[model samples]
Target chain A: MLTIHNLQKIYNGTTVVNLTELTITAGESVGLVGNNGAGKTTLFRMILDLIRPSKGEVLSKGTNVMQSGDWKNYTGSYLDEGFLIDYLTTEEYFKFIGDLHGLSGGDVVERLAPFTDLFNGEILNQRKYIRDYSKGNQKKIGIAAAALSNPELLILDEPFANLDPSSQIRLKNLLKKFREEKQMTMLISSHDLSHVIDVCERIVILEKGQVVQDMQTTENTLQELETYFTV
Target chain B: MLLTLLSHQWKAKLRSSIFQKSLVLNIILGLLILYFGSIFLLLGFGLHKILGNMYPGQDVVGIFNSALLFCFLIDLFFRFLMQELPVLAVQPYLHLPIAKNKLVHYVLVKSVPSIFNLFPLLVFVPFMYTSVMPAYGAAVAIVWVATLLLVTLLNNYLLMYFKRQMSTKPLYTLAFGVAIVGLMLLDYFGVLQLKAISETLFGAVLVNPWLAVVPLVLLAGTYLLNFYYLKAHTYPEELELRKTNTATGGDIAFLNRFGELGKLIELELKLIWRHKRTRSIAMMSVMFLFYGFLFYGKGKFMDGFGTLIFVGIILSGMPMFNYGQFLPGWQSGHFDGLLTQKNISPYQFYTAKYWMMVPVTVLAFILTLPYGFFGYKIILINAATLLYNVGVNVFVIFFFSVYNKERLDLSKGATFNWQGVGASKFVMMLPAMALPILIYLPFGLTGIPYAGIAALGGLGFLGIIFRKQLLQWSANRFVAHKYKLAAGYRQS
Candidate 1:
């Protein structure tokens, strides 16, 4: 479970994020929707502690994640390639991240075994470094490595942007399966409303640093969510 | 459109926080020195004497015209060698509505106004004016010089545009080396009769002043030619085309000699190789050989067996010994990975460095031997000195990193640092030379003649032979000062 209480972020002396009292429980899937500059990415980064919040706490269960009190050892994220080291091979990178999370190399290989040949094993011995990987392939690799951790909390920012439609659908299904199997909690942000609609159960609409609407997907179409987005 | 692109490029560079602060300070200091020093040096006593000796019978106008042409050509040579393609600004416009040819033209035109184009003209014009034009009218003098400036700008821009497109280090090296050799050969042959050329060229400054238009025509033709080449090959971001697919591990036959230490040395060498600018250090490794030649020859300016032996050690060991002076910064990006590895011993790292220097020093001594025309004793001393670098200097310098403050720009021109290299290694050399003398001096004077030299050579040989102990001990000291090392890595 994650809780963001009175979270605020300022940029160049102006408050860009000012959300108040948001929470999601374990196994819950949340779609964060906002127009450009509506602070979805900023909120995710503050939660991951990549950036410090201007005010208030990003809490996991009862502990403040921001104070360096406890890392969501359970959290895996790719806000951008900042989480990935490009010098590494896709396999080397996944193994290194797995090691960081205290998984053995064998354990990582076992988890990745099912999907290793999915990209025609073109990736495994491709000898192509991450920097040379196509934009979509890089996204796939980052997302795959994040999922490889079997994290309790997985957060992805703009996961569908560079992905081909098939990969996008495949990723949505995988997220669904992971949430069902491990009861994982996830926060995914995307500008493409349909990807969010197809995958996410509950939607939290943000506009100008405000959590303007929290609605069940069955109750409204994505178009109904836009009134909340208007500045 | 071209002006807008140029302005945008200028403003973008100016707005970059790092670029603005650093470049402004760098430019201001450079301009101040260039302006003041040129004036002072122009006023210095050597000018009239130097010009007079060089051009005995030639009138000043002939001298001035030739000098201007010569400087304009020099300016073009430099622009080819040193100019940077502003690749970043061109990227965004590539997919825009603008025609690629037009964009390329804008880039080529924009390059003409760079600071480098102005430098030679500044140095030549005023000095030539006062020195050369006393016999000519101001109208003829001013117009002739303006023609020179126009030609310099025109040709300089064109040559650079082509060279920038074909930029490769080895090509530059070969061309530059050949150019230098040609210039030297020309001087040595005394075939050009430069004094006459100087006199005629300056004299031509006065007679009708019409011939000065020739350099301008050459400039315009070359610029048009450059624009054609640039348009055909406008690979926008090619300027930033740093190769990332650097072949790791030893595929080369010579690298197999090093074993694992060889692999590491290979990796380090590859880093130097791939980054062409960084290899300036290795090339400079060759320059270090010249120090002995400066002091060692029998009829040379400063001949001494001891000085030659001393320079021998210096030429070989100084760079590697000096390298650790910027201890942490070289290891900056990989510090987290390197530090967390509890498996590899620090001595492994230290010894690998020694192995790298072994070949470095072998090359250094072999290069230094031509200077051994002084004696075979010098060759023997030089070999002993190479071994000495492997032993004593390598040990102390690794630990010298503990107090070192230089966080070298690993990304910058690797061979040179104008800010200043550290003094610890240099200070350490005083004792490296003198302490062995302490052991050698009393024994040589009182008992066996040349005993001091033998003892020093013996100690150097043994130190290299017993380098394991030296490496082991330094590793411990380094571990103890690990915090400082970490801090140093972050500094660069």
Candidate 2:
């Protein structure tokens, strides 16, 4: 459903991202691996239309995402904390997003029904202003909101870092369940190759803003990815 | 090292547009303050004109002494309140194989060139030179001015030492705010009996110029005591936890009162309270009030100027003053989550903001009401002005919220204004000024008190009638300006 062709970005007169062509079919779970500042975020921004690329276009379902009203509805992202409004409680935060996606409160609760215990009264009526929340708690609330929209595309940046191991596993399972139920497309980026290796159908390694390798996760596994990372 | 510190101070001063503007404006403004100050001296001139010659106590030295005490109080207050104690410069030397006391002394020395020290001299010297110089001769005027400076400096040094001790205590922010406000109120209401005190002090200074040295002993005593406190209580943890707990008192109170809005307001309040810069609402208000005093008290004017002063004093402190100036950037970190999920309308967002501004406007009114003793009808005008402040001014500017966008980093020094305040304040002042004129002009010309009352009611009713439309317009305007405001706050 997502497509990128010759997506080039330049900063300070030097190219940071120059993705010649890339596409993921609807519902496909694709993983992007990259060096730090390898233009993964720039790519993500292109996909979200947060920043402009110097050339080329990113399209979702044959429509250019940068120009499409449908893109905001179909896509969910957690890449920028500046995108977060600290004045809101987690509950109000979730409610605002769901409303934007035209989801009813009941639908939101039904969606959240499974994760109540995991959140552990830690987030309920957790009226603590998000500004006062710990980084991990903010991460928990952000991840929870992303899944609440039940969108066709979900993109996460370093989603596993602040999360506890158990919650990370739970997120993996939730992503799995969503993929099976809705055939949702996921673009996930992370430093922990092992975490994505088990979940992604295909892996693409990005080094310095260009794809160095693209292969099936079945072929690389965590060990091969580890070897690639170390080398 | 001293030169480096002074140059750093100058660099910091030069970098600020406000400081630069003030220096330029003050040259013009200084002449005005001095020229107007001469009028007070001309009260003695008027006395000279009236009683055939210079009568004892015929001049406005009473005003000068009153103003001098004002200078004294300001220096003392800043010495207590400002945390720019130059501890950072010496932070590099803390590891230098130097004794802590020597390091502390260096920090203390660095504080003398502060903006606080400059203000008194700017104020007193001009008045002394213009008023007393020709009358008493330049040498006597110079002595009088220096005597006043030493008095202010001695108080400043003592307060600095006092702050050294209090920084060790709990609830220092709250205590500092309370003490300053209390002291200011005492001075403001003239309960300090300033007119008599000044005459006595000037009489003393005239006889024995060396008597000014008595305050120096007190200054030295305070400095030594404070130096000892800093030396003995140099540990970090002594004052840390108290401030942390002190911040929570407002949080709980706000949460209890505001309900959900209270929760949001509490977040906003805590943001301001935590960041000394955001808490500068009081400072901004006082500045507005102080500005009004300069224009109002500088002249003995009729009702319209009084109305302007009254409104100026009250409305200048709109709670939303700088808080909502940045619109949504105050929510920078968590906005994504709020944007992504749940369901909040633009109305709810703007509603919370309107509610927050209410108390500040109310407090501003209460503060201005005392000027009624100057004239009771002026009090009525101020009360009418309060309604106009709310209905015409406060509401109109709520819609203007997008323009003057400055995201205050609460942690930044109140003086550190990197956040670029856009042209909204300049634009907003037009409607705030114009609407009041329109509302009052017809009634004002008639001199019918009821007409003024009717004008106020009519304006408020109009605001209430159109509040929904204004809010809708505000929401749309804010949404449009979101990205611009957001980028600006982050940049600042």
Candidate 3:
């Protein structure tokens, strides 16, 4: 569960993220849809406590996210290349993340078996560093690493952007499975309307750092998102 | 088209965000260049007199000729180390309508303006103009100067060609280095007469101006080779293939015993070995471990314990000062992930970093232990500095690390790199180096050097005993600056 109260992020006199109040209960699947400067990442950064907000707070499980470390315990986020240690091998990266989460090497080895479908056989035993991987492959590695610890809360920004069609469908199915099986709370942001509509049970539309729409996913949610962005 | 390409490069340099930020570094580098230029000019103009005074009635021109070849060889070695290929600069133009040959030509020609090319001229041209021109007729002097310049240019392009080749296959670098050393040894022991060869080559140029064609042909040959090499590899895929190979995985499995701390240390070691900046520092620090021999062998610190302790601490703590000054900035690439992870404790992170330095410092101290053969005093002083380094200096490094708000790109080479540097880094070095000396100065000056060494060591031992408290203090400081550091890392 996460709560945002009068959260505002100002950069050079412009409000990058301004949310008056919002909350998401545990096990809720939320997709954040925004345009180019829509403050999607800014809001996520506030939640992750990567950056300090100029006004109000983001609370996780009744505790202010900025003031406490409790949220980090259950949160796993992959926003961009910053989430990866680019110098490490993909396998090493996973193992390092697993070790950080108190998972043993054998446990990590066992866990990576599931990601073989997502990896598409290009990532493992590739003998290449994550830096040298193609952008799409790098994204797969980041996404897989984000899910390494199986945290309660997962956040991904534009996860489907660089992925090919096959990987995108695989990721969607993966998300659906995780949500159904473990009730994992997810906050995914994407420019792609169809992908967001497919995975999220609820969608929140952000425009110019303000939440414009908060509604349950419907049969016509994709059509509604497409119509809104027609211009 | 080349002019347009060059103009873009000029704009890129001027418009770089780093350019404005590094204005002070640029100015300092400019002054350093100016200073080196003046020294070379002085050496050039004074070469005639200095050689005359040394050789006394021998032909100075012959000596200069013999020495010129050695100078060019040394210059070639330096260029091999420092010269970066301009191939990457031409990447943006690859898909453009420009011809591949023209692009390659542009890249090769761009290297002419380098400081390496300009430096030798300052040293060589003056000596030739003032001495050789008047000694020989104008025609021979002109030919000699042209030959020297051509040889310099030849070395530049030849080294570039080899460097490009070696980037893909490093065996060539080793073979060339070995061959050069072998040749130098052969010449040194009087087996091969390089002096005779140099005298004959230049003497022939003076006899017949047309003999300058030798160096001219060599320069042109080297240029064409580089030009063709770049032309063949201009495709993005080919360039990428040449730039990087599949990374061979490394194992630091022994670290698993230490649990999370060991894992962090393993990651840090891998990062250091894998990245250019950190790799260079790591290699250079290991090389500097032998620095104690400079003091011990030369008996430079025989007069007092003060200077001895200074060298001892520096020798032991070299890696800490070099590597620790960056801290979280070195992890800027992945700082967000590191901070967001729940399982990582800041105290443990600090402890892991502090403990990593212990091995390196201990390694350097172990290497320097043979200095005890010189004197018991030297060994005692070094032991004290070693303790000071392990206990006090490492904590200082960690404490000052809290102020590192700049982000560093680990992949860039350390030479002339000013990335992620701030006032905090400069100030950090002061207490790191000064604290040991200040601790040693009191009893050292009062004729109680043993007590000073023991006191410094005792304080360091105390710090070691209470390391948990020290690490907690450092972790608290890190937490205070955590957001500021993250903000800076984001900007970078």
TM-score (0 to 1) for chain B of model 3: 0.93
Report lDDT (CA) for all predictions: 0.66, 0.64, 0.82
Highest lDDT: give the candidate number: 3
List TM-scores of chain B, every candidate. 0.72, 0.66, 0.93
TM-score, per-candidate, Cα-based: 0.57, 0.51, 0.67
Runs in model 1 deviating more than 4 A are A1-231, B1-40, B43-46, B53-86, B92-119, B167-202, B227-234, B237-249, B252-262, B290-300, B304-310, B318-328, B375-384, B402-459, B481-492
What is the CA-based DockQ of model 2?
0.01
**Isolated chain A: TM-score per model?**
0.92, 0.94, 0.97
What's the count of clashing pairs in each model shown? Answer: 8, 24, 0
- Tens digit of per-residue lDDT, candidate 3, span B397-449: 88888787777888777766777665566678888888778887888778887
Off by over 4 Å in 3: A1-231, B137-139, B240-251
> Would you give me the overall lDDT of model 3?
0.82
What does fnat come to for each candidate?
Answer: 0.00, 0.00, 0.00
True-vs-predicted CA distance for residue A97, candidate 2, Å:
50
Residue B281 displacement in candidate 2 (angstroms) = 2.5
Error of 3 at B424 (Å): 3.6
Tens-place lDDT per residue, model 1, B1-492, is 666566556655544333333544557557777787676556433454566778887554455455554554566566544566554445444322245566777777777666666655565566556654565667776776676677667766555654554544557546754774576467559966554565576466458678777767877787777677655444432344353343554466686786766666666666566544456666666566676656665455233345555665787766664454455446555665677876556777777767776777677777767766777767766666676666666666676766554344554454324332434545655665655445655765586635655666677788877788888888888788777767655543
